[model samples]
Target: MPDSVGKPRRYRELTGLRLGTLVDRLRESLLFLPTVMLISALVLAEFFDHLDHRKIGPVIPERFQFAPEVVTVLLSTIAGAMITAAAVVFSLLLISLHLVSRQFSPRVLRGFWRDRFSHLLIGLLLSTFAFCVVALARVDVAQEFAPPYTVLFALVLTLGSVLGIVAYLDRVIRQQYIGNIMRRVLAESLYLIAGLPYGRHSGGQVGEPVTPPEPGSLGPSLVITAPFDGWVQQISRRGLMTAVPEGTVIRLETRVGAYLTKDTPLVTLWPPPPADQQHRIGQLVARSVVTAAARSMQHDIDFGIRQLNDLALRGLSDVNDPTTAAEAVARLGSLMRPLLMADLPARSVRDESGRVLLTPNDLDHAAYVRHAFDQINVYSADHPLVRETVTETIRMLQAASAGLPGREAARAELDRHLGTSRRHPLLTQAARADHFRSGDRRPRWRSATTRTG
Candidate 1:
């Protein structure tokens, strides 16, 4: 389903994403930064205009104050440079997007689309440019006005924008590497798991009771139909909990990743809704659900894993780049390493009063294991580099999964992989794992590992 895991910080950022309202989207738009900077610059100019009457320029430290002409020159130069930098940043972003799509997967762009750093960096550059323009205009209008404080502030912003662009470019460069991309995906998944209901360090971790609603126990089911068509990206558990009467059990029929159609069974309320409250409650419940044209990692942990798997599959395609495929396995290992000690897929949400507000279908440890490695395992056959990397990664995961729900499964998978390697024609005619253990060079599995490593 859509919203699987999201941290408190990310949840706040997500509210800025409006599925239906253009105004909310505008608030979060990159152009909003320049708009704010223009308005602020005008306001600050007026403030400095008033301060100019109070002899503020002479009061300002001599080091900070510039002559009126010098201030004009500084603002003009910074403004022009920022315009050029903004154009360059925009071009680089487009080029990188194309490169990643060609080399990786187009689906990976969903994660980047919502990247806060990218948005903020673009906003910063545009804001600096807008502020400089406004400041320079004000200075030009005033025949004798220096606006020393305004000039200093503009200078500071210009310097910050310069340094920020450099750092942002570095980040973009690092993201080009497959390993780095996987690491980012892993980090997002970790944050998502950490932010789930059961993720509170104060509460019990993985072993918490996770029983699904029994058929008979769930009272009369009232199907809530979808109000519109879209993917269920996020569920506002708090909104749903607050709207439904206390003690009402909500059985969600739709999950996070499902594509909804008009009249799709979204959820089924227990005991059904009364005549007067039915329409009103349905509307409220619908309000709490956020739908998007596409899936997002804001709540979808599996989507992040799916991205890595896509890369692995890409590497295994006719292109036959085993090294890239191996990178995906290594990254998955890095992602699941922390999962070895943590639980996932929160089954229920509770309010401050400790009432069960919502229960959505969730992933268990076994499901997580399968989802992370299964597809890659299927595609990695015949490619010894990808296969051995997977085996070694699973070995690392098996060691990490001790006392975890998926420990036995990981161990079994590890043994199966080791045992199967001997059967591979590339490995040997003897379907025994001891070939490599015995230091025989009948197969070049070691070389595959070396190249990928």
Candidate 2:
């Protein structure tokens, strides 16, 4: 069960169990057993000393008696000390269990307990050996000996040694185990927090219908027109294509089914409508047709604006170098030029008196437009504008192509455009900016124009 803090309550409960088990196991282990037995022997010895009138053979010494007051004080002090040691030992055992659980896998808890048992046994053996040595040393003082006092002192020393060993081990284990566990938990939690995805889904969600573009939007809309002044394309799915005026040429780039941009060409034309069915067609169809075109164009304009903005903000010369003031200026130039040129209406130009004159005609305008486009390209290339604009455009095209069908040629065109501008001076500037400079060293040539000019 989760607690108020969201951590599993079972973990806390299991931790308590581990602590309880550790105390019980330690008491049964050799370390505690020897101490218990030694204290018991000391008490028995004191009891014998209290039997004042008891007589034994000549081999037994009479000087071994413990005074009643001394016995009472010794037993009381020893009992109090034993109780304190037990409490300390219990606390140590609990701490040791917690440390072991945190440092090692839960699977290793058994091995850890086994190791503790072994250490306890070793301590007990060492205590017993020391006691034997002390006993031997006192043999020479047999005439003045109080066996009960000797036994009690030995028990106290042995218990102190065992408790000291347990305390030291507990401290070391707690430090190592707690540190390791805390570090691991912290790292894992951070990774989970960073890696988990959290967001609202965009685009079409499950069971949601595609929203059609709004009417009257200034966008590229597709209008199917009569080709060759003939009747509409007789297809079973009449609704598949929208009807338009006869002789109306629908812009291929305009949104036929979806929103389009003005840059798209008119690919299909419609002939005059049949006189017999002309009266039946409603004016709303024509209006819808125009609305579709406008919406398509609007979408294209929006897309273009977004592309320009992104280019202006994100375009930088190098992946490593922070974007500089110069790089930003170039990116803004790239973004602005397209918008300016896009807003201008189509014009026809004629060479007259060594000057160009403009007129409005659909035909014979390609050469002039091409020449103008070439001039714009040359100006952009010569200027210290965003060099990465071309590269970004190509990347976007490539990305778009990956999703679009039958756009291999468009992708190829974009690739060619990028290839031409890849060696532009702005790109070179970006590259130079990215070049590593040691310490505070700066580049000798700060501007691309200096090299080109």
Candidate 3:
């Protein structure tokens, strides 16, 4: 396949993934935003100091202008208060995170880490403290010059910081609600789904339709093994294609979200490259595959699914919160509904000329649906409310997948899960018979008392 064909679109996809990866990391980082705020605060201090030196902006009345000593004292007091307040604010946040991690699944901690609002709060508190410190140093008692504008700005920041603490508390409280947590996970999952090459709503295509070489005609193959152990995060198909010679056929042995141990077969190259070029090409292929210590929601839809499953499992644990488990089940159904409408890419990825360059084994809809709901089914078997919710969610998925192209297998998969749920030993004969129908409201509550097990 000619490099020119479909290369532009592929390049965009690769670049977008890199940019997305960087953004996700930044969002999760605690230092990036606060450091930015600190730098901006320093620049602002200097700018205000310049303004105060020339006395150009916002004329200050003689009566309002304070002596350099009073300004020094004011700045010191505000700086000390801000540092102490920062401590209290972050301590409260740490307490909240601990409680959240304990109550919900620790896997959900990523959500809290990516919270821009909390990051902004931290930046504000630190920036206020830094600004005061810089402004305090600028006080020139020898020249009898007090930066009135800078002091005024410090007071404003102090007031804003106090209000921000209140807002942060309110946000933390709302975020702790199980319903909101599910919604956040659902929203993030949908976002990832939207970026996928599959589905009618997606903007880009994985590759042109193409047929692979017949197995009998395919000759000897070279295998590339991973050098380290990590979870496969991203595979840059375009990068791989560009690194290989023309007409090279490559098949990925692992897909995103798969954990790879050292020496794991990473990829297979059919009609292997020349002896001298093999090592170089292998290095490029390995470079194209990104691995990380932990799973991320960037491209791995299953990670989000896993998070919801973890939440459900936590509910089914000693927490004994069936309502939370029910909420999680409903959200999982919502996550699957979009995939039903999406047309997933074929295993074969082709060039612009319809030549197959890579064959990636992506998780099909059935696998995702099973990954999303199966565990909730197993763990929540005894909880009537959770059981009813899981049944209803499977029904919802069935309805969404009905009549959609390329979704027959997924629909069958849902039917199988639904059937398995109905056969739970705790369910009555009547409940099993009426399983396909809407859950009976009275039995859901009545089942609590009529436990067969």
Candidate 4:
């Protein structure tokens, strides 16, 4: 059940999730920033033309002034040059992105897409082209008049574009480095983790308690099926609680990351609502749920973890780069620390009155840990460098999570992977296991049961 004191926090988290998803979509799109800049450039051009036409600005010195013919030629040249430069810069960026995807994991492409610097560079270049094009239309060679300030502004943009491209290239080169890529992914993942609706627990109930009906007391159940096939992206828990009538019990048939086909069971309502209210309630429930053609990190923790794991696997592949894989593993461990210490919310959430309102099938802490590292464990089994890194990462986590509810379960999972004997002596409750040594070259054990006896 959702914590009584945590209801407000949960609402804020969901609101943040919606905002984050919207921002992410805008950031990922190629047109959003450029389009905004283009419009700004056009507006600036018109403003300058107005200033020159009304003779509002200070008079320019004769040396700085240009004939209408000269101004038109310059604007045309700048327009053509900006467009050509933009084409070249982005073309090179695409090649770099392609190589980075091939070298690392394709998932990292999202990181590149979210890069603001690259966006700004392209926006500036395109906007410069747009400004010059608009300014050219304001030139009046027949009347022997040109917008002087506007022409000067176009020149300034041309210079800025040249300098921007150089800096953008440097950024692209540095971005290809594996360390930068991992750090970028880690930062984004951490942000997503902080806003997640888990970990806060209070003793008191938040809503009024409603008594549940006895087993089989429900006359008939209402099964809500998926309207279309797609991934379960975001489910608004608060929305679900608000839409349903008091005392209604909701069972979520799918989770945030699960994919559903058309007509698949999406939700089940127990002790179904009155005949007249069923359809309206169903529509509300559907509105609260969101689906997409692809997975995203907006509310899916697993998706972010998957990106890190993919990087680790790339390191373990024919590349034979254990250092890179170890780095990825270390970050994964850091990411898992907070999740281990916090109190995960219950699958069954109750109203203020303690009546169950929402039942969601979210993955538990142990399951999340396994999902983050299971694949790396398989491939890193033979590489001691990577294997020892995993060992130390889990050891740190086990020690950090001491006395927490999730500790024992995580410890048991560690034992399953590295064997009981491999559990570092310091982190174990039992007396030191002499067979294990931190510095041992080959720490391999035949099985968890392998013993000196």
> lDDT per prediction?
0.66, 0.35, 0.77, 0.73
Kindly indicate the candidate among 1 and 4 with the higher lDDT. Answer: 4
Q: What would the per-residue lDDT of candidate 1 be over residues 144-207, giving only the tens digit for each residue?
A: 5477667777888888898989998998898788777777777877787676544422122322
Give a tens-digit lDDT track for model 2, residues 1-453. Answer: 101231233234334434544464564354565576556554544453443124332333345445444444544455455445545555765666676554333322333344454354344434444443444333333343335445455556556656665665655465444333333333322332232121010000111112322224424433333222211111110111223332232222222223333323223223324555443332322222222211111112222222223222322322222233224333323333332222122221211111111212211212222221222223233234433443444354456445444344444444444433344433344335454256735554345324323
Worst 10 residues of 2 by lDDT: 199-208
Q: Write the per-residue lDDT of candidate 4 for residues 160-271, one digit (tens) a residue.
A: 8889988988988899898888887777667656654442211122344344444367557888887778887777766566565666677778777778788878788776
Q: Please give the lDDT score for candidate 3.
A: 0.77
Q: How much is the lDDT of residue 68 in candidate 2? A: 41
What TM-score, over all chains together, does every model reach?
0.73, 0.22, 0.87, 0.83
Candidate 3: list runs displaced more than 4 Å: 1-16, 62-64, 142-145, 198-206, 211-217, 353-360, 420-453
What candidate 4 gets wrong by more than 4 Å, as runs, is 1-20, 61-63, 142-145, 196-220, 353-355, 421-453
Steric clash pairs (candidate 4): 4-206, 207-352, 207-353, 208-352, 208-353, 209-353, 209-354
Query: How many clashes in each structure?
Result: 5, 26, 2, 7
Better of 1 and 3 by lDDT: 3
At residue 321, give the lDDT of candidate 1: 91
Clashes of 1: 5
Reference-based TM-score, model 2: 0.22
Per-residue lDDT over 1-453 for candidate 3, one digit per residue giving the tens place of the 0 to 100 score: 225554575567667766766877898998999999999999999999889888786687666577889988888888888889888878877887899899998878888878998888889999999999998888889865577788888888989999999998899889889888888888878987886665322323546757666645778888889988999877777667765667767788888889988898888877788888888778767767778888887677888899899889999899999888888888887888886777666677676543355555678888887788767766665678887787778778888888887787787678666653344332343344444346543445345324322
